[model samples]
Target chain A: SAVISQKPSRDICQRGTSLTIQCQVDSQVTMMFWYRQQPGQSLTLIATANQGSEATYESGFVIDKFPISRPNLTFSTLTVSNMSPEDSSIYLCSVTGGSEAFFGQGTRLTVV
Target chain B: AQSVSQHNHHVILSEAASLELGCNYSYGGTVNLFWYVQYPGQHLQLLLKYFSGDPLVKGIKGFEAEFIKSKFSFNLRKPSVQWSDTAEYFCAVKPGGSYIPTFGRGTSLIVHP
Candidate 1:
């Protein structure tokens, strides 16, 4: 299993402000993914961050609202732009190794 | 599109009681199944996974799951429950050769002491 860490474990921000969450992995990985978990709900895939290229976002999500950047194989960042109250959720980063996948501690963002 | 469904949303059980949580996927082709647990205030942890070969797979903390291909079901079970087992359980499925997993809504299990 890989040791994954995310910066800003928990943050409270005013509406209209943006926050970038950072994910760092202990080892290099090919694919890194971002997911959002609403309060009392299942996780929704936000996008797949590819190193040196634009990320592939899922349906119901767009890059303009949730921009992602992967500078290298072991690090990625997700910026929630123009945040609102509805944007408050737990953001998690994941990477796959072998047959299993591992997740970071997750960043809990609350937009007031 | 691949999707997973967990029948129970919340389950309450007393200590030493048996536990079962149903999970079904909407894929007819080959798939990999997994069960994950999330304790309060912690990240999700893998319980067990089934890729191939064994239909009945055992996992940590006296937990096990059986994969019934025809029914597209992989249900988690434990003979006895403990208060420490009170947490959220999530079922996930990945297609034949896909690395991405689709997760279920998750089931909240509460074991009364």
Candidate 2:
């Protein structure tokens, strides 16, 4: 399993602000997945980032609202733009290790 | 569209009680199944996985799961439960050759000591 590190473990931001969460994996991975877990809700995939290409957003996610950047194989960043209270959730980054997926310590965001 | 379903939303059990959390996936072809557990204040960890061979697969911490192809079910089971087993369990599935996995709404298990 790859060791994943996420920065800004917890944060509080006001409405209309933007916050960027960073994920770094010890080893290079082919696919990096971003997921959101609302309070008491299931994990919903936000996007899939592959190095050197544009990120693919899920059904309800968009490029403008949740922009992603994967500059290298081991690093990816997800930015929540124009945040609102509804955007408050735990954001997690995951990578496929063999057939299993390993996740990072999630970023808990609270929008006021 | 592929989807994973976990029938139990919340389960309460006493120590040494048997556990069986039901999970079902909607897919026609070969699929990879997994069970992940998230302890309080911790990240999700893989409990067990069933890809091929041996419908019954055992994982860390004495946990296991059986994959029933005809029933389209991959249910997690444990002969006995402990306080440490109290956590949220999620079932995920990925169709063969697919990189993305669909996760079910987790089942929260609470075990009394």
Candidate 3:
């Protein structure tokens, strides 16, 4: 089992501002995933963060808008840049090794 | 593309009522199934998972799920529910040979005391 500690449980930001959310895991992992859950919707994968290489983003998500940084195996940060009202959602950090996946408490971002 | 479908979006039940949440996947080959629960102000927690073994798998909090390969369904069931069981439940499906899993839209279960 893995435990994740995510920062900024909730944040209210203004438009055009950026908010970086941090995720720290109790153990080192090979892959870290970032997800966004809009109201009344399921989780949407934003990107996959690896320790050495650059983050692999999914379709409809760009690095400039959602830049990810994985400095080490146990830590990663995702920045929501140039926030808009549409960007207001819950962002979660997840790590999977075997069959089960562990998720962070999630960061609730509200852009005004 | 593989996807998971959850039939119920919202459900309201009285205390001690039976509960069932439907989950279906698009994959035909081997797959891994899971059910997760998220209470208010909490993270997603695994309720149960089915890798391979008995079709009937029991999970935490007396929740159980049956994996039917022919129908491609893994539905969650609980005979009796309490008010504390009110939360959002999500079903996830990980296709064979894939590490990442696809999540359903989720079902909000509201148990009335």
Candidate 4:
């Protein structure tokens, strides 16, 4: 299993402001992903952060709203742009190693 | 599109009682299955996974799941429940050799002492 960590374990932000969550892994990995878990709902894939290229967004999500950056194999960042109350959710970063995927301590974002 | 479904939204059980959670996937092709557990205020952790070979897989905390390919189901079971087992359980599926997984709505298990 990989040891994953995320910055800003919890944060409160005003509407129209943006916040960035960073994920760092203990070792190099081939793929890193970002997911959103809304209150009382299951997790939804936001995007696949690919190193040196644009992240692949899932349906119902776009790069304009959730821009991602993967500068190296062990690190990636996801920025929630122009936040809103509806954007309040727990953001998680995960990586697949071997056959199982490991998740970080999610960042809980609350937009007011 | 592929997806996962967990039958129970919430389940309550007493210590020493049996526990079972149903999970189904909607993928026709070969797929990989996983079960994750999230304790209160804790990150999600892998419980068990079934990629191939054995249909029955065992995980930590005395948890086990059987993958029935014919029914597209993977159900988790524990012979005896513990109060500390209260948590949210998620079922996830991915296509064969695919890296991305689709997660279910999750089942909240409350085990009473």
C-alpha DockQ of every model: 0.68, 0.78, 0.84, 0.76
How well is each residue in B11-81 modelled by candidate 2, as lDDT tens digits?
99999999999999999999999999999988899999999999999998899999999999999999999
Chain B TM-score, structure 2? 0.98
Candidate 2: interface RMSD in Å?
0.9
RMSD of each: 1.0, 0.9, 0.7, 1.0
Candidate achieving the largest TM-score: 3
Q: Report candidate 1's fraction of native contacts.
A: 0.48
Tens digit of per-residue lDDT, candidate 1, span A71-97:
999999999999999999999999987
**Candidate 2: regions farther than 4 A off:** none
Error of 4 at A15 (Å): 0.7
**Candidate 4 lDDT (Cα, whole model)?**
0.94
What is candidate 2's CAPRI-style docking category based on DockQ? medium
Per-residue lDDT of B1-105 in model 4, one digit per residue for the tens? 998889999999999999999999999999989999999988899999998899999999999999999999999999999999999999999898789889998
Between prediction 2 and prediction 3, the one with superior TM-score is 3
DockQ, computed on Cα atoms, for candidate 4: 0.76
Candidate 4 regions with alpha-carbon error over 4 angstroms: none
Tell me the spans in candidate 3 whose CA falls farther than 4 Å from its real position: none
